[model samples]
Target: MLEEQLLQRSENKCELCQSGETLKLYAVPPQSANNVDNCIIVCDTCLSQIEKNKETEKNHWRCLTTSMWSELAAVQVVSWRMLNRLSTEGWAVDNLDMMYLDDETLAWAKAAAEDENDEIIEIHKDCNGSPLLAGDSIVLTKSLDVKGSTLNAKLGTVVKNIRLVENNTDQIEGKIEGQVIVILTKYVRKQG
Candidate 1:
């Protein structure tokens, strides 16, 4: 219901980039409410980059300058978040200076970054420096002994469907011999 409303409100285009491709409902975080006021329509590119599931193209987010002035709170929140993420860029810094939000919305906009040290969203990567995401297959490049078990994960072991360890960029969880264990990302390479 809320998604339908957002879709109509956005004219079936991505509210941020105005792209009419592969739209999805992106709920503004820290609220988790499924209402129109807290959700915006986004394209696949925006969603993947926002979640750090893929590398962000800094140039792609230049649209924030226009979206920042949206009357919808959800759009403003996402715009503020993206602008903050790109704050190191000169244009982003200038737009952030010009953007304004009321006290309550400003607090909500800062919630995600406030607790993060350095305000940078961490990206998980494999030994080769390729970005890693949940459910990606990986091959162990070095042998590792399970800390509390007799199992020794051998070199060249294929660990299928790995889960990224949130809050830590250097580790991932995968099952070795039916035992789910944390593996250091440096010891594995993303499998094709």
Candidate 2:
């Protein structure tokens, strides 16, 4: 299995801090594939510290100095990100300056920084401010005209198995009258 392969690659130790206790697979974010190139084996302490907010402990991440030079792209990416976060620390800033990633890897690291800057995770919500999830049915609170078609979705119309639109919190896709259409979240209400 992939887990075993990862375990073998890391020699049954955490890739970051080399701790064998409580090891788990950590997938590098914004990755399309869940393969070894995009995943790293890490211990619980390293995982929790990496995922923590801006107030993370500076001493705990000194291990990055070694992990930053890892052969794996995923490890390098994570190291680059952590180093960037801790750049305010003099040692971290020096490491960031010394670290070298290929163009593609550098782009991936920069993308993570951009995502962190936009900290508000956008979520689809109904007119009543209730959260919407994929596969949840919703009722239209206001009638809407189907763009590029003659179908007029009536008020109180139920849309089943809704899919949230990526990058747009105010829209969702649902089937109405056997045709899939984009419905504004503001005109919908979560169904019981």
Candidate 3:
């Protein structure tokens, strides 16, 4: 019944890492967020692993020679990212020479990859840990009335997982009581 039923179809584990910690629904051909063919189930670790591919300036597909044969686009995407990241590896560079992506699928993958919004902010943990990244839900420990705001946030309130403000390091933004606000990450406890 979740928007991302793909997780259930793929089973609750990350398709790549196989870790079950947190399964999330992500759009594969991110352009089609509403289409099932474009959605996939991935965990935070696998998602980050796949995301690492986008940070690279140049990509080589040799590392994915075996992966290119995968029928699943999500698998292909993950493999492509890994191959791109592995371009510096000696084996990958040599293999890149033989890697071939069909013009259509390659174009689809490339277009999907490039369309991601890198400027989007991410919230993280407040106790000197990472920022409150997206899709992480947490519970509040103390009641707080946002400064300069009229909202009455209650204590022990469950704040659905939060997203971080990309450029800011101290705030985790979330919605509570139908109002969206930025909260100190330290004030919330990560839910299991």
Candidate with more favorable, higher TM-score: 1 or 2: 1
Q: Scored by CA lDDT, what does every candidate get?
A: 0.86, 0.86, 0.62
Q: Give the TM-score comparing model 3 with the true structure, all chains together.
A: 0.44
What are the per-residue Cα lDDT tens digits for candidate 2 across 1-192?
788999999999999889999999988887777897889999988888777733578897899999999989899998988887765466876687679999999888778767767242455778976778899999999999999999999999999999999999999999999999999999999999
Per-candidate clash tally: 0, 0, 14
Residue 5 of candidate 2: its Cα lDDT?
92
Instruction: Please give the range of 10 consecutive residues that has the lowest summed lDDT in model 2.
Output: 116-125
Model 3, span 22-112: residue lDDT tens: 7777666556345656566677755655666444423333425555555776666655545545644545544444556677666766665
Model 3: lDDT equals 0.62
Error of 3 at 185 (Å): 53
